[model samples]
Target: MADRSPEVAEDVDVVVVGAGILGIYQLYRAREAGFTVRLLEQGNGVGGTWYWNRYPGCRFDSESYTYGYLFSEELWRDWEWSEEFAGQPETERYLNHVTDRFDLRRHIRFGSKVVAAVWDEESAGWTLNTEDGHIVRARHFVSTTGVLSVPQFPDVPGREDFAGEAYHTGLWPKEPVDFRGKRVAVIGTGSSGVQIAPAIADEVATLTVYQRTPSWATPLNNKPISAERQAELKAEFASIKETLEASNVGFLHEAHDRKTFEDTPEEREAFYEKIWRSPGFAKMTTNYTDMMLDDEANAEFCAFLEKKIRSLVDDEETADKLIPRNHAYGGLRPPFVTGYFEMFNKPHVELVSLREEPITRVTETGVETAKGLREYDIIVWATGFDFGTGALRRMGVTGTDGLELTEKWADGPITWIGVMASGFPNLFFPGGPHGAAGNNPRYGGTQVDFVTELLVHARDHGKRRIEVPRHAEEAWMTMIENFRQYSRFEEHGQYYGGNTAGKAKAFLLNPGGKPKMMEAIGEAVSSGYQGFLS
Candidate 1:
């Protein structure tokens, strides 16, 4: 066992294991609630996702006004965003500014990656050890490790054989990559691939994009937010906050509230055209309520999008390859993109469908496929992350009876409202599994509020140990199973569950809408904190 001396181990009321936007807000709230809070971050700075994912053309799909903290009116009014969809650097700047404005840096220990956290039943607290051999003992442990923090590289043969410079979009280096006159090969067609391919198409002498699955992308009508519009939004910040809280997807877009089959072909085409012209993820919302639920309705939207794709691309075959046929529209997280499809029109750009000609291996020159080996100057892996529970699983946490969190979640993650596990006492997870599904920043604040309420309750009752009972956890899982019955997530292989690695499908996010999920959480709290034991 490591040293348990008071001098070596600092004790606090709460230890937050991340310094992202969620962790920042959580630390602030815990301090306000009279708890001595210490924050540990692996990165050199705050902005967990924004700090690492500095890929070219990386930006928020949600609107700027709806994607920030609603807790402080002063902060909201003071921080002005330049664009409707803020880029990676601007988002990072905003997060750093928030940390400075609130003076949160002093509480944060940079480069302190937590390696292990063990629950001490005798002391009724958690003992955490950092990678640098530093130890911390806290009454409460909170994990705000955002879902997309851990990047997953493609498990292709001979990945290390590539002689040229290789980079993953999730873990891009801080220095600017000069793609000028370089032959670039980008793999995967997720949001990052869609964003990166177009952004570098002009810069690179030759750009080759390898696609396994085609993403259904609507045009991001991204433009500068005028000074006048910024002022108006700042003035009505309260109303904006209210709208965000009440909405389903944690944005202000109002659904059309009609069925897709109700409208005529002309009317439907006109509505889709209007949505296509607008910015943000409004296309998913400003349509029939059953667009994601009903197959026939979803097909109509898919056909409409395919037609739009066909119109954008010069060649019919390329456009056909881009159209997603397997999954329904809005089935996976809808990627709002700009110039993704139009990039194919450039003479220097080339699209290789991996589904037709699967990648065989990575050679010293470049990627080798069934057709032949293609040489490149650089390779960009836009492959996604080990999302949902991967970030937390890597922390090496153990609870009662030496129950390892990794072992507990080996099959899949199970929790009561994605906040706490059955055996993990005094530990909270904000924005983890089974939580609200929506704009991450918006739901992040809601999660903070939920955990804070529980903390406050525990303090009021003089409770040092808190956890969900086994029965409660099982019951919650059952609730999640029932809710997912209506969702089409299982029909398609996506990351919604831990399905990327051929794992048994499980509902990772709460299938119920944000409003209903929040209501259920609130109701549970009002009912004497049902499901949780103190």
Candidate 2:
């Protein structure tokens, strides 16, 4: 739906900038609170990340059963997902279903990307500028721009000179991509590459994967949703939602209960095997109490994952090359997929680990590395995002007193709850630095729910603005630094740490302990949204 009013553009009670999960939910809550709302979306339609990332094998790492709106019991019962990890098209459909169900699309301005947002101190409102030079005003603004929305192009030499077609999984074409018989080269073995490689291998003439770091990937065991299972989960929707919020990452699963070293060697081995067989990212680590702490214990778990990779790949040489050796086992983000290892069996598929033979440059028709020039018909830079702070930086956002957010967060992002920044007033960010995301594996929907709660509170209350107190922001910043100080990633060795040669400084996850972060949020909600208020 497009807002095509003939009347002059004017102010609204609240401006929700995005039509993604977070932005949509914010509009729902704001409307419920009796506030007139307007939504601004950059794309032609909604579904934010789902709207953009339509590449082959792009799917949610979280289970489909729990990766949706929990605020409405009706919505939960009515909707159904067809797989453990829903693909992009299905995700888009789900968003459409929600939009139609709630009648939200009516207020959204499709294809309208917000170019600039300036706070007006005198008017006590915000002057927001869209790309087409349309200006609108709003008393309150909520930015639900996702953390991973921006795509990052690697700064490899001759990258722009490539004669072949180049595409990023994050910014895939809406139309169908034909890899019918073309040779394809995929660089970066992060989540996107891990998921797409096997699927593309089945179609492309020859597939070559340039691996900079071998990600720890587990089987999704993805399957269609069953009627009986859907019925069973729907019955327990409230309980599931509550349980998800209690855990880190806001999802439920079986994790190792005992300490890493509490069990005997054989017992630990048995536990590790059990989780490996389980579905999705939940199986990456058994509900282990100490895998996150205790260096020795974490090392033991890493060794287990390494062994699994070795056993899966038939070629010992390839197996060794694929296994991650240096960083802490759980340091880098985990990848969930199907048939990732089997792709190596294909005669035409080759794995070029950047560690051994560093890429020198991109040639006119191929990639030139220390080993040799590997030519391909198409190249996919699945190199991932400039995460957490990139979008805010790239857009040139200036906060109070003309303080630049990019310059302020030069080393890393500093936010109270990955939601609100100190100097930025009346601007609420749903997915900000140090935002409260847990390891429960079902964190996305919870993120939407939690952020909406704050937005609704701000709208409902008569307060004209809410800005994070400077002291509060500073305290939270200290906490983030302290957590990083104790974690394995304090030092930059590879991508997991702060440094990678060309890897942009992007740390999406909040480093603070989930439990403590959630506690702070609870305190806020109880105290009239504690941290920020007029």
Candidate 3:
């Protein structure tokens, strides 16, 4: 529907798949390097994950200051964010602004879902078959598919019998969903559920939140950026960018001092409170740098959070249920919020801890739990996503010797630097398994940027194709497994950060520290991609 030539007669030198943040950057870099590029997206518009997840209160955990492009000074200067952490709208708008400014829309084919991508060894290219029966070929393939793109719906019996509107936060409707004077039952207490429940409760007559597992959440000091602060940031913009790149996660400030957690309990408490008052993702665990490394330090932080949650929620029973006691601190993704716990004080809002009463079935009216049947006009499955391999696996992508990528990654998605597969030649993957995780929020974004840079370099250097050696990939996989074996994090049952979850085994995050992970990438780069042959 967008202004583009028919796919029947279109082809390009390279195909940059998925129009998420990384995909957009890949297109810009490829085009700038004078390589013919075609961008394909399944959605009608740009902003991949943001485009689909339009649920109420959807937001970014990372602050707006360093969430976006660092490659262009002019682009960063032109767009000023309203808050430290930009909401979905601001993030979406910024992407749109970038798209418009760079004219990325021209090369992107909207409403085209790539169903299959089979490698053509003779031509050293990929033949992409779209769901609409359109086929296109490209010499190079770059998958910028997001890590958490695939929605994971739990197996609830009789779900098909539900008469009411059932929606997943990952697949929210494009149009506004009105919950006025209706009973709304929201499942899952992860980031999405925590965010949307509070905002939607204000409108709905009664809101019920079903929680499977409690999460560690702290206050998100979300506020409007003052003009004075904006001006100050503008004055020191160059230094900010430089700081972002040099750091492990590409954040503006250095990661919490590795020695901070070594202090006394009183000293640790004081330090954490100071950092908790600051803006951005570092507030929760970064203050005490050893929070992730040492169990004793982790317990102290968890106790601190338990106290905070207890103080916030008025109901003692609900507060205790809300407080996480089972998992170790920093095991799962830390939930951040503006006023999440405060919403529990509202009479209309209720928390149903599913551990006590597991969901049995979904009837025509609502869900039936072991405790009782709760009727609702609408049900929101805020039940997170399939991380790491799901995004690429769902698309049915294939590699050399007619090997299906999904089959190869059946055990778990493995890669040397989380960039390329052993069998997949000339295909680069950003945000794959064994790359960035936990302590490295900005690593995935920065790595994607770096991958784009390396791609540009390879193109400019006249390399027709490249592939990682099987031995190198095997070595990297062994290193990752060993890292997980030594770390005590597995006891916490956290996925990817090194837990033995069968389904989450393929998640793309290095359990080791970000500094070490980035160092590995730097070493790979210095070797002129030694393990990879062109």
Candidate 4:
């Protein structure tokens, strides 16, 4: 439901931005804490990413059962997911159901795009200004704007010259796109590109996928859950939730403590085959913990994956091009694809290596490459996003003493625990960088719970503000740097290492697992929230 108010409210205990999954939960927690909460969403409805990204074959990398909110048992018991990995429509439906079920729509102001958030020192609160010329003031400001909310268009020349229909996978159109007998060009080989290519291959007359760097992809043996399976899962929901909480990636799966090289060739191949056949991103996590840490261990897995790729694709050249050689195994966010590589076997599909023939510009009818030009009826930009800090920075957030978030994070984002930054009082970011790397929903819930506890403490003590101390912030930064120094993620030019521009940089993920993160949060809270000033 959209807000009926002609003007934005001036008096609210808490103002939540972005009606994404995190924002909805924040609203629930804030209201439960006996505070007047208002949620501002840029979109017409809920489900931030799901609402925007309506691309074909778009689905969660995490399993369906583990990707949802774990706060309510009633929701878990009532809702039944059809697939092991839920698609965009199902995810959107689930979020909408949650919103209506919890009566959260009354407080949500839809179609309200927040342009700027400025902290007023005198008022000791935040003044949020929207694009539609409305100002909202709140005692505490929480930004649940997702990491991948902002789409990053390529800096290619003459993109506007394309006369054909152009669409980005991140911001796909709601209406169905008819690709029958039409040539489609998909630029980028990330998760979105891999998924889109396979889905539209048969529909289009020709589907050309432009790849700069190939991503490692595992098979997703996605299938519908039977009534018996659903019942068994529901029965074990409590224990499953506990297992997910304790997991490093927030997914309940078997973890091999031994090194990859420790196993014989036959034993390793058998282990790899078993995991490869299993559904979802667990294939990357379940086997050999040292895959990301040790190059030798990573190489073994990479060889196995490369062999699999070669065997799957009919063309040797295509298979070789698809296999990732530059980065170590588990370096990039490996996507769980369904018939992605196999799509190349179809006569209509073609893989364009950007390294061999780089894109020169977008012509009037098609894309012009260094080698030549290729005609297409439709163009899809799967160019990915700025990620981590882009969404918040785009909103023009200003902290104490007019400290611009962009300027502060000019080099890179520096958060205490990816939850709160120093000098940003009564402000928190759930599922931000320096937090958990994978399974955002589970990690987000943990962060929200911690932030809620902090909010309650502040309210009980009559504290006007709460912020991370400068010393603690510095220590946290140092700790993150040290962790990056040890991890091999920094060696690869992937998004996890702040390498979106194809240049290796500092690692962004918290090196410690979920349990370690939870432990740190517990220690901080038990120590009278030692790092935080209330």
Which portions of model 2 show Cα errors greater than 4 Å? 3-8, 439-461, 486-508, 525-531
Q: What is the lDDT of candidate 4?
A: 0.84
Q: List residue ranges in candidate 1 displaced over 4 A.
A: 1-7, 490-492, 497-499
User: TM-score per candidate, in order?
Assistant: 0.96, 0.92, 0.93, 0.96
Model 2 over residues 111-138: C-alpha lDDT tens digits?
Answer: 7767778777767677777776666788
Steric collisions counted per model: 0, 16, 1, 0
Candidate 4: clashing pairs of residues: none
Ranking by TM-score: 4, 1, 3, 2
Q: Candidates' lDDT values, in order?
A: 0.84, 0.75, 0.77, 0.84
lDDT of 2: 0.75
- After the best TM-score superposition of candidate 2, give how far the Cα of residue 444 lies from its true spot, in angstroms: 6.4
Cα error of candidate 3 at position 229, Å: 1.4
lDDT of 1 by residue, 151-227 (tens): 88877999999999999999999999999999999998888889999998999999999998787888989999999
* Residues 1-534, model 4: lDDT tens digits: 544464745679899998888999999999988999889898888999989889998998788889988888899999999998889999999999999999999998888888999998888899998887777899999999877788878788999989999999988888998889999999998889888889889889999999988878889889998999999989998999998887778887787778887889999999899988877877877878787778788888888899899988999999989988777766667777989988999988999899889999999899999889999999999988777777888888899999998787777788877888887888899878777767888888889888888988888878878888887778778878766666555344444534366423555677764765777687788888765755
Candidate 3, which segments miss by more than 4 Å at Cα? 1-9, 254-265, 438-441, 453-462, 485-494, 497-507, 513-518
TM-score of 2: 0.92
